[model samples]
Target: APLMEIDPRSPVPKYAQLREILLDWIEESRLGVDDAVPSERELGLTYGLSRMTVRQTLDQLVDEGKLYRVPGKGTFVARPKIEMSLRLASFTEDMRARGFEPGSQDLARRVAPASGHLARVLGVAPGDPIHHLERLRTADGEPMAVERSNIPLALAPELDRHSLAGRSLYRLLEQEYNLLLDSGEQTIEAGLCDATDAKHLGLTAGSAVLLLQRRSYANGTCVELAISTYRADRYQLHSTLDARR
Candidate 1:
């Protein structure tokens, strides 16, 4: 349908009709990543819409990650979001499975005394030594997430000696240390990216992000506590629902 086909007599509001038209264009590949969207004035004139309505439609699209704005340039289509399944897999494995080259930049790795909260989470005594590892996770050389992990030193006493660059921690524990990672529990929530994390992710402070906290188990023992912050604009979580569950 043409951009000027918005119907005034139909039950749908003008703004919604315009929104659907734009979405159709995107979904049908009429608009592609980095493709400049029609200017607000152009769209308004073509569709006989007010500037307010056109701007509102564009703003909603931007918030939905269908479009992005450049400071001096106009709005453009955004890259397609990566749909991530809520599966118990390492970031390295997940990205590789998705056809993206996975890489990690070790930001911090040190032995630290477990705090009260960390003690309970990692099944360690308070003040016990634990390995704290922070890394910048990347996909295809693009910053994707920030992962902070805590592992009880008792589980992997020589963890520090291992080379972790672009390696899967889960795989290292399984292959190098002969530990079987059988299960995990993960909780996810929406949050604003902190300045420190945002800088690592190449996003402005307070940008939307997905916070995932996971506890991985080996032989029924909690082995690692990891908190990951993912760029919301580039990733989305997917899950399958079953009535039996």
Candidate 2:
């Protein structure tokens, strides 16, 4: 069925009415990825709304990742986000399972002291050895996320001996170190890309992003602390809900 016409006489706010109408346009393919949305002035005129109201509606959708704003290029329809299922799986494995080729580019790798927050999260003492690994992870040659991971080096000594470039960290832990991943806890939040992340992800500074902080465990012992920033326009999180009586 066609979407209901925006009711100017109804009790519902005009901004909401316009927001839903535009969303329907996106779903119906009247607008597609990279397609520019109407200018605030044009939309305001079309809907008989003030520019402030039009801007407000657009801003909300931009924050929701339904639209993206380019510095001088105006707002455009965003690409569909890739749904990341809530499960304990490495990026390489997850991509492969989804039929996408996974790859990584090592940005930096070094050894550092696990102090403060890092020490607390990994259950290690202050000044304990930690491996700081940063990489730009990709699927099908498209950059997806930048992961900065810190590992307690005492638990996996000589971890720096192996080359992790474009390789799965979990696979290395299991196949070489004999450490099996048992569980992980993660949280997701909406954020804006910083200069560093924006440059790596091919987005402008302040573009929408999904920030993930995760702790992975091996046999109930803390093993890794990872902070990953994903392009919000191209990534999403999905979870299944159990129906209750």
Q: Count the clashes in each prediction.
A: 0, 0
Tens digits of per-residue lDDT, candidate 1, 85-111, equal: 687888888899999999999999999
Give the distance in Å from residue 204's predicted Cα in candidate 2 to where it truly belongs: 4.7
Superposition TM-score, candidate 1 onto the true structure: 0.96
Candidate 2 C-alpha lDDT tens digits along 144-244: 99999898888788888888877999999999888899999999999999999999988889988999999999889998899999988788877788999
Regions of model 2 farther than 4 Å from truth? 1-4, 38-56, 71-74, 189-194, 203-208, 243-245
TM-score of 2: 0.79
In terms of lDDT, which candidate is strongest? 1
lDDT of 2 at 48: 81
Worst 10 residues of 2 by lDDT: 1-10
Q: How accurate is candidate 2 locally (lDDT)?
A: 0.89
